[model samples]
Target: MISLSKSIRWLFCLLLTLAAAFPAPAISAAAAEPLALGSSEFYYLAGHMEVLKDPSRSMDFKKALEAYGRGEFLPLPGTLNAGYGRNAYWIHFTLKRGVAFPEKSMLSLSPSYTNSVKVYVQRQGRSPLLPSSFSPVLLGSDVPVAERPVLNPNFVIPLDLQADEPVEVFVRVYSKGSISLTGQVATYGSLRNSTYYSIMIQFGYLGIAAVLCVMNLIFFFAIRDRLLLYLVLYVFTVLVNNLAVSGMSTLLFPNHAHLISDYMVYMGIGAQVLVFSEFSYHLFHDFAGLWLLRYIRFMSVVGVLTIISVSLGFYASVVPFALIGIIILITMLLLTSKKLLVSMPQSGIFITVAFGISMLGYFFQIFRLIGIIPLEPGWEINMVEPATLVHMVLISIALSERFRITERQLADASRLSEKRAVEIAEDMTGELRENKERLEVALAAEHLSAERQNQFLTMLSHEYRTPLAIIQGNLDILAINSENGGEEESQELQKMRRAVARLVDVMDVSLMQNRMLDLQVVGTSTIICADEFIRQQVDAVRWMWPERSFTLHSELVEESVFGEAPLLNTALFNILDNAQKYSPCDTAIEIRTWADGDFVMISVSNGIAGISIGDSESLFDKYRRGACSHDTSGAGVGLWLVRKIIEEHGGTVKMNSAAHGRISVGLAIPVERGETPYCQKK
Candidate 1:
């Protein structure tokens, strides 16, 4: 009797299952019917839904249908999220005809990270309540690129609807990485268009990543900055990870699709986290404390572990470690901001705001994965992509700020150095001025002593001249009285008189030369005719030496000269006297004067015996005598005095010597501007 009861209960359960599977026609039809709209319409499935999980992945469509009939399937959750797992997730939805949408529609499952996806569609006319009634189609990253209905990186399934018919769809998704299944329904044409634009945006993401990577790399090389170097590594790893996740790498590297698998994607993520953590640690080194340092080290270890696990084909295990690293990075950033607030509040506030905005897209994605944020259908917004760009921009700004601060410090140091140099230069300049003034004072004292010596010599010469003149007078009386003595005694008296006269001449010439050497004691000045002056000197020399002849020549112009007339007469007399003394007593003394240029020139030539042309250089030096003047009875002051006086009057004197015993002394004095007639004719 218990066996019979068990049989009856089994039959009852079977009948109940059968009844649920095949409801009454009207009710079944109504249950299968989707919302009715116009022809060729497109819409998301908005009716009752069902979802199933296949942990074992052994269940077929028949069992899945049976599970749905038994109410084992739950209402459609926000998304089909399996997290990072190997389990397959199935989502089921029913759609009815909607407002006219041209052409057949398509279903898209985003994002493209899923390893494999299978889509099934059932029409109401084909036993829609049964899973066996559905036709299955496949699209996913694992599906061969050439076999896809739409050749796009993301999954797209085609859907065709008949008039007034309800349609149902089931999507199964599985992946070795994080499983995110967001389903979207739209016209096939619209989906293609969306796919085109999506590709363009993905390329944009790639372009931005590439450009920023290159830019930061340039800065890294230029500045040798540790932060910039790590930043470039982080950006490059992140870009590779994003490409793998987006499945674009599969299309780009079709020949090497196996090489760019989910393992590499996760590996890249680990590397990105590792580099980024290092960057953060270095950037905030000034403000970080012990705990923060330890936290960074811990994260770095985890990041390394994640990379090892992913590389060893343990991507599933590395997901959690990657998550832990992310959490630590975020914590470190927040704490760093707090520390910066105490030291640099303004910069801290700005950085905090920037980090907050940049982190939005990243956290939102995480929230969506954990079901903390609802999954959005249609084109999934990648908050992380734009957020990453913003973060990179913020990093650049921070680097620039650091450079600016450094430059300002260097500029300050440079200015201080320049100021010190200028101060030293000024001190040296003052010392040099003092030294120059002392040298000038010493020079003035020495010059004064020389003038005193010259004055004493002039006084001594005058005193000797008086005594010598008296001796000459005594000699004249002796000569007259000696006429009574023998010829020998008379000759001795003549010789003594000549000796006395020569001594007197030497003393006079020496005194005059000494006075002329003193620049402060110049001859008294007056207007004098140069031609008449020459004649007076010539006539005086003629009277002194009657044994010597003289020739006085003149070419007078309507020109005058201002000077000490007596001194000039003395200079001319000395020249003529020397001409007669040095030459044969019978040789003619030639004195000629003429106007040459702005001055009147005088030439005094005499026949000298053996003077060379080269001897003219030392002819005017003090105490210097011409080579042939040794036999002459006069001091060498004759030509030297003429030169000094003419030079003082802004004129010149030069000596010319020739062969054949011919020598000439030329003198020129500048003519005065005021016109005057010659007072004495030639």
Candidate 2:
């Protein structure tokens, strides 16, 4: 449970920290500057060239120039530039034969200032690129080439012809930036391929979401854990975020392109908030995050509609859309900041913190963009930013811990099984050795042993009583269950459990008396509603066997104490459980708690006998049931375990007796100053 809570806490911290502590976006991101375009008008030139079926007839430098020399720009058929980041998209363009050159026959030029371009001529794995400025490709006609482009950053030289032989050409646009592409590009032949490639890359994340969602569902079926519900929501949010950024929705869901692109940011943000919030709430029992979560849910509805309205209203104009986007974005952010995970369960708070760091990184990007800070482009804010990756890694850690806890549990069980196996094997081996030694002396008397076994069986009265008692209780349970069991049946069940408990007590006491092995008494932890347990224990002792009048009192009642509530209840119950056991039928028992100097004392005094100051020290010893009372039912181990437990909790156990035979038992557990009466119980 602790391990589970911790995983949930880290995830919460990460998510909460993001929503709460995210730094404000930098100024530049807040304010967009109008980019003034230069005086050059865009030149859109169109032309066509034939694709050559034969490689021998392929265009080299001479053929391209020969075509260019005729009139129009030489057409390189079937060339492609798919997208900004990926280089996989194939480009197919044809050039007239002899357009390919050994030195400077044909050149592919990209504008030097293009922010999003990387070009390469078809080559095998390696390509020499040119410098940043005026970099143009000069194809070598002498080399045997493959189908891909030679990756070159520089494409500066001009194309010229060696001869007029007509040839076909093909080139590829590996990637591109905002800068202009001039000099030459052939007529486009595969619009379908280019569009499909863009769409598929955009939808890649949808595939990712589908996989994660399916896995989450499978996990839900297997584990039946509510965390999987949030996981599914989380995966869904990532898919929506991916869709908006990658532009798949623009292609596949074109009718909702403008709407989807604009509103996806809001959906992505809100969905992520929901996933993280839900995860934390179910994980941590704390309700501090409740109201804030409610607020986010309420505002999210408004934010979504506003996005749809504004985006639809302002699609043609960048200003209205951008301004509306900012308003909704800020509002959305404000809503998430309140609850997050940190507000409720500290266990899940790390997830929030990680997200917070990532948010800070984003704010930095926004600041730079808005001109609040000066930061380099392409190097500073990006998807690969350190903060973002770290956040994802933290979340992964939380996921891994869940698996780790389960693994540890399995490993522990396996170790216990192995230990038991070893013990069993040793016991069997020892028994065999003992039988062999006995056989050496008793081989001839083995037949006489049968009669001895019968005599031993006849002497079993002492050994059979406890089992007979248990069977007696079991028979009572059978009779109760045979009828429609009401209070009577419940009493029978309680008797059975208590019978089993008493038998355990006897075994434990006998084991201690024999001292067969070294023993370490481990403690147990239990939940307590402190006030109620104390009141009930005191009241029950006061009322049961009412001739023993008992008083209940409290100076400071810790409402909730985590350690061994039931056992403590049983210990106090032992006090009460014993006050009833020892009190004079007509005398009184006093129960009170008050500040006794530095200690808070909970003492139970009953007018009874069989206890003295010395017995206080030794009466709690196992199997030391005193003869001062007719209570043969007392196994004498109850107070021993009680003494051990309370002393371990840093408290003392004391006993007192009067000449009148009145007795009292007092147990004090140190209540440290300002210690949480109820720190969360493990």
Candidate 3:
């Protein structure tokens, strides 16, 4: 049994040796010598190179080189791209330097999405070393940037060669993303120009995408349209994905480049799919079936979840989600287009064209990444290059076309409305003209009536005053006669005379106010001391109503005022009279005068219980009276006259009532142009 077991083990060992001795062919080899590096500065590498597949991914540099010496390598089919594969690829090439070529050359591997890249060179004196052994020169995403032969966003390898010396080069590449080993060997100047244009194209795409994003965002807000909003999101995701896939994000997030580069593909794909789904939903919403919409929403949610999963390092799940999402999206678009073709034919046609253009570009890029299509060396094209710009332009065109249609509809409606308005105006024109003629006749009659009324009032005022003067004469005679009779008779006579005097005063003041309103009696103003003028008015009130007790208080800082003294005196007297008439006979009426900034204020307060006043503004209206004035025997025009006179002096009047049923009337008058007085406030 032991001998049999040993024979079996020896057979297994021999089989392994045979497998190692004859590796499977990957591609065919080129018969010509490798392209020489020269002053031309650039050489397409794939067509002139051979490639080997390291299925174990454990094949060290030394073994790979040994395999190369045995002619085991296969020529690169066209370009090296093995999309999302576990196996690492080794590309083999030889370079002979011309006398015109520089001593050093740069090799730039394209498409920065690869996770790891390593280059091995066999120069005139050195032997190839294993990758496990430390190499003074190494370059890849896994290698620290400081350890790289040349620092670059892409994997850059530096070569030192002598004139006419043949040098062997090998590059190993592997990635979770699509493995693309496309590169160029050139002089610094050629490489620099190539890099400049490549960078320009990359940044140009990003710049235009950024601009579209902003524009679409603005369109969303300006037009209040959700389609533009989705467009903005789509543009943003595409920009981020392009930045990640194109390897330009390393420029922005250098320290965190590995993190960005590793996960951004999944993130970008998930986000792009989700945003595109949303955009399509909004774009074709009119024709979207319920199930189709539900499917879209489901896929969108899944895409979002996939993005979360990817961020958490479940990158392997992205492919399934993406595939499912693509299927669902295509079905949705087709169903929507079919339904829209029958319902809204023009819009459906527009959508179909735009979608076709966009999908063409999308598929072109996807196929290129997956190695389904060969990439021509030195000829670079981004999937978004033709796709995104055309998509945006077409969508914008559709939107503009819709806007134009809407405008035409609105214009037709407006024209119809204008025509109807013209007809209505024509129908109403005669009625309006007739109304204007009638208004003119009515105004003329009103003017004549007002004139007659004014003349009658003037005549009445003269006649009334004549009779009141005669009645006052008769009352005086009767009082004299009653003085000799009895106390009751004299008191009756005094009451009769007081009533007559009050009626005459009311009539005179009313007529005077009428004259003031009619512009017949304009009172001229003169600078007068407000404190002295108010005191004189208070003294007159005391002399007239001796039985009614009153107190006058003055706080004069700037007492001079520009107003008619007689009018101001009359205003003050009317307020005092009203205060006395409304208050109980025993209650004293308090009149106070003070100076506020730039004005003199006269306040008359009385403890008139049950006097309920509402809005102070309405109280100043002509003929308006306080609620408590029902039993009072005076015309309600007293406060109104006071307000009118004060307002004429460019001042204001306000009325307020306190908690104790104390009503106060405050009158403000502008101070005259003069020096302020020394005040002894009381």
Best-fitting candidate, measured by TM-score? 3
**lDDT (0 to 1) per candidate:** 0.68, 0.46, 0.71
Stretches of candidate 2 off by over 4 Å are: 1-210, 254-269, 283-357, 361-397, 410-682
Tens-place lDDT per residue, model 1, 161-190, is: 765566767777777777767755677666
TM-score sort, best first: 3, 1, 2
Q: List the candidates' TM-scores in order.
A: 0.54, 0.27, 0.60
Candidate with the larger TM-score of 2 and 3: 3
Q: Top lDDT: which candidate number?
A: 3
TM-score of 1: 0.54
- Tens digits of per-residue lDDT for model 3, 1-682: 1232343465457435544553332455454358677767677776777778898999877788778778788887566866555688888777788988888778788777777787767666554434343233455554555555655667777777788877777788787656777787788887777667777888988898898889878877988888888888888888887776776776677677676665576678788788888888777666666666776787788778768866575555365546435543653474356656565565566666767676567655655555555666854567666677767766766676766777788999999999999999988998899999999999999989978887888898889889888988988777777776763455556556756655655565556436446523665767787777777667767767889888988877446887666567667878888888878888888888877888888888888653556655686777777777788776667778788778878988888885567889888898887653532333
Q: Residue 98 CA error for candidate 3 (Å)?
A: 20
Local error of candidate 2 at 80, Å?
29
Stretch of 10 with least lDDT, candidate 1: 24-33
Clashing pairs in 1: 40-101, 41-101, 526-563
Q: Quote the positional error of residue 206 for candidate 2 in Å.
A: 4.7
Sort the predicted structures by lDDT, highest score first. Answer: 3, 1, 2
Candidate 2 vs 3: which has more lDDT: 3
